[model samples]
Target: MPPDALELLSEKGSAERALTAALASFQEQVQAVPSLDLAAVVEAAKPAFSSGIAFSAQLVDVRGRHKLRVIVMHAGGAEVTSEEWADEVDDLLQAAGWMLAMLLGIPLAKQARPVEAEIAEAECLAVVGVPDASAGPEPSKKEDAAPVVDLDVALEPLTPQEIEATHQRILALPQASRQALTKAFREHFQVPRNARSIGDRITQHQHAAFIDHFLEECEEQSLDGAAAPAEP
Candidate 1:
């Protein structure tokens, strides 16, 4: 864990309790709203300025606890035709991302917490423009007119290099060998994405709770060793 992460654990149990309450509270608020839709909100947000954009969200586990992470699809939308307009759009997206997190019961960084969002222009292309039929009849070539929205975000937990290295290590070993390692991991590892490092195969079998129990057992053993009498 990083230094900051260790500090974060100071409030771990309390934070989890808070998050559970927040999730319930936010869900009620969302259900009560007369008209609140993420997709619609995103669509409405597109034209306020000049950039083409998309949005999405996902759940992430931070130190064995579930957290909802926001992914802002497109980091920077189309070239900033206007610096002021671009800045405004950037602000809007950042706000929207946090707003979603608040609604979903997740606490993000005071700074910026970006995660992979499941958003993009269909077929892997940046959507170039919002639909505008005000000018005249809609063009037959729709792709050229409305750019597909792509929203993606990057966050910490594991880096690409680290993930790749873990994957490679798993792949190099036999399936049984890999499975055994993950079993041990499930029994002993308490780190984030360790089982995932090997591949989803391990994560599928290992629960975070199991890892927690293993850590407790290790701590008990360490304490026992420390209290033992010194032999001649």
Candidate 2:
């Protein structure tokens, strides 16, 4: 968070304290990488973003629950918005964080997956053009040849037809757990905008890779990221 943002939040009344704490806790979560030095990474990370898509998020207390609204602003003057609620403010913030990473075209780190998330990720690869994302034998041309992508080649922006097809696949998930996860995946990965035009080199490669990494992390997450409710 920017110092100005923090300063402004500190001035808000008692009701805003929960949001302040939530933001603090969420910061700890994202910066938990042990190998990275604590102060150095944060000092370098937050600053003015001059170009590309920007993410604007707002979290407010709703009775005892927390309501999160995330808006993805494209450089082209287009935007996408989504709303979700959680009893815990941190949970909603974390999910928003993941969606932000995806939208900003951040690269995902490889992680082990739980059995369920692995299956969900594989099913998603079916739509995103991952080569034979299925665990089965490599698809053949005469058969149901799956689309192949060479990571070396530059990636093209998703066509409306492709976006529609991928979205339909996201809606086909059998369980709400998987559906919620996939929805976040599709919403960001399929957003038709110049991601590379943003911070860092957010090329289409990052976009495609984000799906695989994000899903693996979802499976790897304890309590399954913010997509799942807290276990009682």
Candidate 3:
């Protein structure tokens, strides 16, 4: 295999090993919680020349009623330093672990200790290419002010009543549906928790597009639930 392929294979192996160890630790930590049962599978391949790491985890409760699919991606170059690579993989594992913990109502900080140390030690040899901070062209006022003009007709600040109404709508969703919507909204807009207005992170046109998509999803879910036969 070529060097990059070999390096990716090595990283994949390390990540799998760390995940295995972490799963054991996670199981032990959750043993005391009678209501929680969790399992995870980490995919074994990290493709060569890939720009980032991507993985999927399936989480299910003991009775299998609540199932969650988690997909995580961390962006970085193929030529990252060993420390950066370790950090990236560790971050993925920790994220999966924490998500599982949250679903099980387990305390993440208290249970993730052992796996954290194990992941920290799985280091390899590699060189990272760092960009030169001073090499970029100077920022011009024209470039900085261009967005203001573009968004002048396409965006408007939300009124307090509108924000409150949106919050109320969100609060009316079932817990699982609410969580899913909240996560999707946050990821799509890349906004902080305090950004209550749709226009705070996107143009008015974009906001309307997202609202349409969100409502469609909600409607689909409602139809699915209605179609599903009542559980025993």
1 versus 3: better lDDT goes to:
3
Worst 10 residues of 2 by lDDT: 31-40
Global lDDT of each candidate: 0.34, 0.41, 0.37
How do all the candidates rank in terms of lDDT, highest first?
2, 3, 1
Q: Scored by Cα lDDT, where does model 3 land?
A: 0.37
| Per-residue lDDT over 1-232 for candidate 1, one digit per residue giving the tens place of the 0 to 100 score | 8999887776554544443443334323322121123444443344321222233554445666544344322222211110112222224344343344222322221222222111111111111122346646755544443222322222223342333233333333323333344555544444453112323222322232233333333334445545556689
TM-score of each: 0.19, 0.30, 0.27
Residues 40-60 of candidate 3: C-alpha lDDT, one tens digit per residue: 222112121032444446544
RMSD per model, one decimal: 27.0, 17.2, 21.4
Q: Which ten residues in a row have the lowest lDDT in candidate 3?
A: 121-130
Write the residue-wise lDDT of candidate 2 on 120-179 in tens digits: 444444443333446466455213432245755437654323332232232233333333
| Cα displacement (Å) at residue 205, model 1 | 12
Candidate 3 — number of clashing residue pairs? Answer: 0
Which runs in model 2 stand beyond 4 Å of their true positions? 1-48, 60-65, 88-92, 111-232
Candidate 2 lDDT score relative to the true structure? 0.41
